[model samples]
Target: MSQLMSIDTFLDSEEVLVDVRTPSEFLKAHIPKALNIPLLTDQERAEVGTLYRHKGKEKAVLKGLDLVGPKMSDIVRSFLEVAPKRTVRLYCWRGGQRSQSVAWLLEQAGFKAKILKDGYKSFRRWVLNHFEREYQFRVLGGYTGVGKSDLLQILENKGAQVLDLEKEAHHRGSAFGGIGLPKQPSTQHYENKLAMRLRAFDMRLPIWLEDESRLVGKCAVPEFLFQQISRAQLFVVCRTIEERIVRLCQLYGVEQKQSLIDACMRIKKRLGLEHTKKAISLIEAGLLDEATLIILKYYDKKYQYSIDKRVVSLYLNGSEMSDVQLAERLLNR
Candidate 1:
């Protein structure tokens, strides 16, 4: 028989985490490092769920068996191919039938597969609760195009514990944030990734993170983490508007003319229709610098409004130093 492993034991072990949930479920959110080897396909799970609703428990079980039984030997063989040492850690959505069945089949095939207690939901709970703990946070705050993200990366290169949340969310936290990035993960999955990243750091040392509003594209920062960010030590980088506009154009100076116009259109209500029209026209005319100025007028004002709400602990004239120099100065102090 396969062994039943507690979440802690499974975590402490060296075995690979194999998720047995459907591909759709695994794609939405999953425990980090989990290799998905679904016991049932997406359609099969839906069919089984529909069967359970009206055909009674026994009928549902039989239907699930009918769907999965054909793939049993192939599944076991594929898992062994991933874990050649005959050891594996398995889980499903709620740690019920799917993982248990897979564990049994794997054990029958001479593999010592262990099922995670309470499955992925347990890990989700653990991560959600992880945000409640206190950690020393040093926030790098600045207006748009102030190069805060670049400085954060510099700090990381210099051995500082930095949490690049934009990197995590694949966004720069603006109307144009998602332009060049892949689709954002759901907020739940973002929290899961954030929690996993936090676990690697020593909380005693101040974690350097870029100041972010709660929403990054579609992903929202967890409430506890957001509260921490709101109250953390702030390092505001002060740079000139002209300099910031130069940097913004450098960061977003892409050849995708339509994309740039569409991104600007997203904030048309806030930017005003006249301003938006002018910006789009400038972009169409190959005048990115002029278009950049128009957009920055709106973004800068909006960012200033947000900054006005926060207490600035310190403001550093970032124009005086390179990003690496700024990073070193901030960390050394």
Candidate 2:
């Protein structure tokens, strides 16, 4: 006899959260920091699902048992190794057989195991609902190379709530975005991360975020999130084109030459072949300043297009001062 619980019931509890869904499903999105102790492998789960659809529940249960029998001891060992408290909360796709069966097994092994009332699907619903709520977002908008990411970090250090979308997405929102970073999370996982971050913030205070397109690398910002940011207070960080170009070079100059050239080539159609060739040549020749200048012109136009589309609330001149000075001004406001 196990207790059925909602995700919120134990999300911050001392009990360990174990996702009993298959690894692939867990990888796409699971409760943040939840351990994956799958009740079935991807192939096994598929087989069970097919059997359930065509044959019947009895056949599927039998097959699932067969697949899980040999792994029972291993599962127990893994669960205990990770959960020192001897209490575990389990969930699968929809609080279905997989999670129930795991709960039974864990309980039999002398660990207190509870199942989520509606499982991971329920958690996902909670996540989506978070975005649907109205929020007062303090947006930090700027052209490319305005050091917005650095400023967001500064704001965070000063106790302001800041969501670094680029950092979370492991991208800088450009062709050169992936130059030196880990692989970005799947869109599903990215949203999961965002939902977690959203809950952590105090809604009474303004939440700071960088203005971004719907897309960041391979990850797309959820529609409700994009909508709120669009409607929120929008402020631009103004910087000189020359300064932006210099900043771009500082950021990308240490990157490998081939990486820079590949990034340029990625936008060849937009850059035009002649400009692309010139940019690549300059980068290869170690004249990174000249190379970045050409790329900045293209980026500046693209950013201006974004600006033109938005109803900007204010534009803060940050070119003449250090990021720290700019951060102080924004904080006072």
Candidate 3:
């Protein structure tokens, strides 16, 4: 007999997690570490869905059985490889027929299979609702090249609760952020990953986050969490333009010059045509520091505009303080 369990119970258990949704569905968003053992292919699921809408549930059931019959042995073999313990936990989009069917099949094959009570949909609800919970957020606000991300990493190593949103999004929250990063996860998946991390955090401790606009590349910060960040304590870091230019050159200088130019062109409208051309010319001349200074004009102005709208809790001059010293101040504050 298959048992249905709450999402919390499923998360706490160490059983092999199986997602029986189609590959496309799994790709968009899924529980972390859940293996894809799709009961139907993308096309097959679509075909069945269309039939169910046009025909009745009886005809749809018959069609589904016909399609799945030949694949039973293969499914069993695949499950056996991943589930050496012969114990499994699985879910579909909803705790519907597809998951129930798979659970029944596994049971008949002499395996213990438990189903997630409301399936992936329930997990998603769990993910979204997590952002609404209260958190003590410490937002690190600074202009480009101020080393905010670096400091956040140090804080994490010092045992502070930190949410590295850029790491999760594979973006640094800048026009050039995506130049050398891995492909960004879909926004849905980004939320899923963030929620998973948040679930493991101790809520009593302050969560350090790099200040960002709502969107990081293609991923939008969950709205409720973003609101909390906005109202939470803000710490701004300031550094000289020359200092920032040197840091920017060091970070981006190794990338292909063409890639750098393409990044500049992306913000051409905001950067202005004349400034954009000068930045491109500097890049071609291998004067990365000069190019960065030009780009910083736009970014610095934009950052200051955002900072002006918020009440800053503290400001640290990066020119005077080492990153280690600054981190200590933040940690001890």
Best by TM-score: 3
What range of 10 consecutive residues in model 3 has the weakest lDDT sum? 245-254
Per-model root-mean-square deviation over C-alphas: 1.5, 1.6, 1.4
lDDT of 3 by residue, 1-333 (tens): 998999899888889999999999999988988999999999999888898999988888899999999999999999999998889999999988989999999988999988999899999999999999999999999999999998998899888999999999999888899988999999999999999999999998899999999999989999999999999999999999888888888888889999999999999999999999999999999988888888998999998899999999999999998988899999999
Q: What lDDT does candidate 2 reach at residue 99?
A: 85
Tens-place lDDT digits, model 1, residues 173-290: 9999998888998888888899989988998898999988889989999988999999988999989988998898887786488989999999999999999999999999988889
Each prediction's Cα lDDT score? 0.88, 0.88, 0.93
Model 3 segments beyond 4 Å from truth? none
Considering every candidate listed, which one attains the maximal lDDT?
A: 3
Error of 3 at 8 (Å): 1.5
Q: TM-score per candidate, in order? A: 0.95, 0.95, 0.96
- Could you tell me how far off, in angstroms, the CA of residue 30 lies in candidate 2 after the best superposition? 2.1
Q: Please say which candidate is ahead in TM-score: 2 or 3.
A: 3
| Per-residue lDDT value at 68 in model 2 | 93
Question: How many clashes show up per model?
Answer: 0, 0, 0
Q: What root-mean-square deviation over C-alphas does model 1 reach?
A: 1.5
The number of clashing residue pairs in model 2 is 0
Q: Which segments of candidate 1 are over 4 A away from where they belong?
A: none
In model 2, what is the error at residue 138, expressed in angstroms?
0.9
- CA lDDT, candidate 2, residue 136: 74
